[model samples]
Target: MLTVAHSVPKTPEHEETIHKAQYNVARAYFMGFGAPSSEDDGRRWLDRAAADGTRRGSVKAQTMLAMLFARRDTLDLEKSFHWHSEATGNGSLESQGALGVMYLYGLGVRRDLVAARLCLTQAARRGNIYATGQLALFYYRFRFYQHAVRFGTHLARFEAADVAELARQSECLPGYVRRGLATGCYVLSRCQLLGQGGLAADGERGRLLGGRAAELDAATADRLQRLFVNGPWSCASYPDLGVEV
Candidate 1:
């Protein structure tokens, strides 16, 4: 039965029709027939479909191509930045986040903290969790500076409220809640320890919160601890500073 069906003579017209049907099926698969389990397979079909001028395939291909380039550590940062920027401009949130980080670290462009903050702000507004964490950290550092300028003056009620809101936003971020929690704990600890911004001295509570921050991520905890131990706070500029609990 199978051989008989296979032997059915196909006219030139029928052959053309079959070819068109196959192409249509291929197009469907390219769009995500089973969503291709392997990256190589997905890329292969996406490339074919993109070459055939399918818009969705082209967009997917471009996004994946940018990702592949960005993942290569040895790739030129400028090229990677360009690819990511293009993808981001096309409305890829992941690309937007990647570009934001590159800008934040000055990987390809001149270091511009303001620009980095702007990019991250855009990503965060789009619901990127990492961007949210970055924003939270930025605000936390800003509050610290504000507190320092006042020479341990109590934080204005509004400033305190802002800190709390930033912290809350950070914690609510989907993928970065732990990091946000750790950051929040660190900021709270600093506020308590230095008696800055009109906060009462609470060495015990500060130590506990600091320890909790470290518990969330050992590396972050260690870094913060080192900053506490060796930073200018221990010097004459800021006296009586120690990390001991």
Candidate 2:
């Protein structure tokens, strides 16, 4: 399946088709979808896909490369930044969100709330639901100039209503995000846990939301499993999130 794509060179004759084929083959291999998984082949094909220079969906290849290099075990932050910067410059909301997260955690670049805000804003404005959730979680309008102060200020100004607004907006999200449904449900579930938006603190609601998210997307389910520590929905103990986003 993987070699089938490269058998026919990607030329001007069938550039779009070839690019799509290569990307599909690479994604299939990467995900082991009816094919033997091989990261090396997947990465090679993704590189070819990005090199195709198709502005339309090349961001997907670039984002994949960025995440591949940014794996915690690999820790090649420079390459991660390089790919993410490419995707971000190409107007990829997912890449923008990822770059914002990198800046926020100082993964590759220095920690800078300004940079984070810029990237997050770019993604959120384009209707990246996860980016919207991040924006609601971390507000950066104030001129705090320090991490602790900025963080404290955001917490102080945080309101439960904001969660409801964010959730309402993310209900019908764009298709650009592969896990938009799962992410939205997860964010809303967190809000439920916190008793935000005039809602009661309900662990069952949180679990139900998590389960629904997992049903919609397996990746989201895996993320929920990590957060729950037991299953997709159940939690041994809920954390204390008192008025803090």
Candidate 3:
């Protein structure tokens, strides 16, 4: 009997389809979307999808694994950072933003503000709303109020969807968009109220912005108020503000 050795499809289209299917399978297992929900199985499939190819893994899979490892009950910050780094090298905007956050918070490595700023700036310039919001917060913390205002204003004026519509269909919006919008409004309100960030004192506008922040995401709004408004702000002591990309 002749032995047969199986090889991965050489066609790029075929390889792409296989990788996508692997991701879909992982998602289905994770979410119970036409499949039984099983985190173990989901993780297994995700690993396959993320580490299968001769080239770097699938960006989506790498990013998702990073998020999963960072957030799951059994957290693994090192694994998360590794995958995010890998995906960032692949030019994934989401991973770039995530890497920035990890660096800012010292999640899996030594905290490095310069590295965080570099990663956040690259992602923010490429339209990563999460990165933009984080950059605003970073600048604000460092007293670079002008830069904070610039980034915050961009998020505050996100007009892709009407506020009322977004409120009515919050679930339809990406987590990053909602969180970014809320963070922007909250930051701007603080700026206006305190006359920082190159903004004049405007309690009325600040109040309105505060209200808008609540509308976009009450939980995020509450978190920001508790961490930055009602108490002394400390980035090291701040709670997680991760965007679910």
Which predicted model would earn the best lDDT?
3
TM-score (C-alpha) between model 3 and the true structure: 0.86
Candidate lDDT values, in order: 0.49, 0.58, 0.75
* Model 3, span 1-245: residue lDDT tens: 00111126468765655666777788888999887899998888788778642344567888888888776575788888888888888767778888998888787878898999999999878777767788888888788998888888888886536544543433222676677778887888888888997799999998988898888778888888888856565444465546232
Error of 1 at 207 (Å): 3.2
Higher-scoring candidate on TM-score, 1 or 3:
3
Per-prediction tally of clashes: 5, 0, 0
Cα lDDT tens digits for candidate 1, 117-141:
7886787676554454445445555
> What is the Cα-based lDDT of residue 165 in candidate 3?
53
lDDT of 2: 0.58
Runs of candidate 1 with Cα error greater than 4 angstroms are 1-75, 140-177, 224-245
Candidate 2 lDDT over 43-88, as tens digits, reads 8889887763346445667777777776656558777877888877
TM-score for each predicted model, relative to the true structure: 0.49, 0.56, 0.86
Ranking by TM-score: 3, 2, 1
Candidate 3 whole-model C-alpha lDDT, 0 to 1: 0.75
| Candidate 1 pairs with clashing backbones | 153-197, 153-198, 154-197, 154-198, 155-197
1 or 2: which has the higher lDDT? 2
